[model samples]
Target chain A: MNVKVIVRGKAKGAVLCAQKPVNFLGGIDKKTGLVRDEKHDLFGKFIGNKILVFPNGVGSSVGAYTIYSLKYNQSAPLAIVCLKADITTASGCAISDIPLVVAEKKDYESLKNGQEILVDAIEGKIL
Target chain B: MELTKEEESALDGKHGETLALAYRILVAIGEATNADKLIPVEWAHLSGVNYNTIGDAGEEFLSHLSKDAKFRIKTTVNPMGFDSDNVSKFHLDEEFVTKQQSIRNSYVKMGATPSFSCIPYEIFELPKNGTQVSFAESNAAIYANSISALKTNKESAFSALASALTGKSPHSDLRDEENRKPNLTIRMKTEPADEITYGLLGYFAGKEAGSSVAISGTKGLDRRSCKSLCAGMGTSGSCGMFTLGEEEGEKIDFDYKEMARVKDELNTSESGDIITLGSPQLGLEEISDLVAKLKGRSFRKQCMIFCPRAIQGQIRNLGYDKELTRAGGEILYDCCTCLTPLVDKENIDAVVTNSVKGAYYLKTSNGVDVNLKSLHQIVEEETK
Candidate 1:
């Protein structure tokens, strides 16, 4: 299997395999499921379930609502896949009720958003 | 798939009525999220200031049926809105009082606090980064929890309330170690512009991305609450136009009832520009000052005022909203009017205002004319 890594870093915790994809529309609003902070690459994408692949979190607290709104609007990706975890994404999962997983640093380095990845949060494993 | 011992007991009438009521509410929330099974809660935050004119009827039932306010979690934080302090502070007036009271009284009988607004960050010292807890629907609270990644179950408002009562929810949807990882990561550096409200700027970026999402994000937000852009904001329109005052700052509180008295007298005829200061939910003296400002001038291409719908209505009812709206410049709701596509596309040149949040969001998102100003200074600048 071809292994590709985005940002090199150490991750702690479980890794889950993803079948779908979530786009990274940058910071998501919690109250409204809209993408926020035009500075982000995927600015203006109502992110739901395309396999959001990101290193960490950014932007305002209100973005949490946007993430939730994305879930409600059917815009959120199947699950949140991260190289490193951040509060923004965590908040999105918490409010959106979407599944979120993290990988070990070695796995996080080898992981890719589009690439098929497996993670076990309870056991803290990533593949 | 069944409730935990604590939850079952609450449902079975083991806990007191208060908790039972919250549990019932949580059940609905879980259903809405399509949670496979509820999970045992770590804690909970009771959100709901004054009751909306309408809300989850189930919560009302739980509140009534369970008077003892049962509790499954060892600790919880529930905040109410629109009490005397909120009424005085935010300017929720008589009509607001009556409407909210009727709704709250129903739940209050079950031990709900009659407060208003959902800025949970204000009252609750929630943990950050995966803090597990169940949270209900509230724009403000949602904002706080999501920003910090405080653990919360995105169940329906009703389900959270149910959980409050029963104390146990199905643990079906809590992300396994595998599913909770973030997939897409985006990073960018904005030319930190002057006069931009730091927080709102982040929001603007989210808004832009939201627009791009396959799903329409705004439509969903509307379902939650009627936004009051004008309610808690201030604006300015001298020479050009701008909103004045920050959502966070030294509060410029008002008495809405007093302002309503002079509601009939306010007009936005001031010529060169206009400046708004703080929330338009004002008292009588403030209205008198506005009417006086409009006494000798006519609105320009820069006719603008940032106000909540309530105050805007008062202005419109007094023959201002129509005049303003007809001029292709009217009040906005929920979110700021200027932030809307209307003004951003139109004549918003070299913006100046008192609100750091607005300044930050606009400057960062659109790269527009932005400046920071004090409420009084904005008025002075616009007229100059």
Candidate 2:
């Protein structure tokens, strides 16, 4: 299906879908790529090299730096797919060179956690 | 999103890695918001100064970027973790001081003005109305949009920095006048008697109305009260701009009961260890007003008054600094009551403040209780 490309790249991995918006700053461990926020449904799961999916970003703007730190530590996700792209997630992926795309509501809802998918943000498509 | 030749070159890394990165961020944001094109901005005010807020990641990133990046337009910064001049007096940790100093040096190297004041609207002369600027500080963004008639989206730290480097912002969101109208209306049922009440009203309104809001029944708000409203609204949610008038939309009533609920949530302590002021740093006018109010009175507890250093020099010239000092008020420059290490949990259990923004941060970020009160009530009861 067609999607909106934010950062251009190609990535393929299993999906890790978050039901709620994520706050990268305090919500995830920069070094470990683990969801540390106790309130998150994806808590105790590692996001390393996986295709992370969420609605959007919330909380502090410093979440951009956390995304960079995740990359610097080599613990970043392979790619990100969201229903909407907020400044925090968009800018973070842009600077970090991570593949990012905004999928349609039906396309995003159809994908389940642990489902394998390939995201080609350069061509703005999902397969 | 269409890009000019220069923009395309920058995105392709012809200009340099820093500019390329900056252009990349702008392009991403523009695509996400569906902006037609890029527009030039006159000013860019940045946040993410406090070491507590940005941490080691930001410190390292900034230091690396400072090697070649310079601000393309007028730029200003927000407060740091502590007062640079009074570092010895505050007894801060050595590592924190070093990291904070590195962050300061990075911004300086990038050609940003060392304003270090959150209320850049008061300290610096504003550009003409309708001028587009990038302000990352939430309170400053709200004030610029709602009060000064300037145009801006509530920019993020990295996004504003990108604008500073490129002198360009996406022509979207609040920057366009068509999107400036209110989506919701908040009718003040109870009279906003003081700045705290106005603050609560703003907080409640922002939570209900995510973007722009029209507020009726609030009139004649002084600079202090307006600033309180901006700060309160900035604190609660992603809501950025608020207009003071009636509008056609879903209406919410801000009655006395609603005010009491917000106050009850913030006012965790009946008493406090210290009295703190200035969540959005006070201006010369506010400082003068405070001096007049404390003319013959002395505070019974330790009072910390935060203001900009430029105004500090003015207060010194007017000899009001001595009056405040004699009245047991410690004047702190370049830092406010929120997210500051000056009021540590080890030394103090709770703080008394007249700012709703201060109360929220002091409780959540600084790890202390708050005794929320109005400026009038604080002066009447805490002074002798």
TM-score of chain B of each: 0.43, 0.98
- Candidate 1: Cα lDDT at A36: 60
Residue lDDT tens for model 2, B1-384: 788999999989999999988999999989877788899999999988888777777889899999989999999999888888888988899989999999999999999898888899888888998999999887899999999989998777888999999999998888889888997889888764688988888778766776689988886589988999999887766677999889997888899999999888778999999999898888888878888887679999999999977687789999988998998998888788878888899989999999998987787667799998888788888999
Locate the minimum summed-lDDT window of 10 residues in model 2 chain A. Answer: A57-66
Which 10 residues in a row give candidate 2 chain B its minimum summed lDDT? B202-211
Native-to-model Cα distance after best TM-score fit, residue B383 in candidate 1, in Å: 4.2
Model 2 backbone overlap count = 0
TM-score of each: 0.40, 0.91
Give the best candidate by lDDT. Answer: 2
Candidate 1 Cα outliers beyond 4 Å, as residue runs:
A1-36, A44-48, A59-62, A83-88, A94-97, A119-124, B1-352, B361-370
Compared with the true structure, the alpha-carbon lDDT of candidate 1 equals 0.37
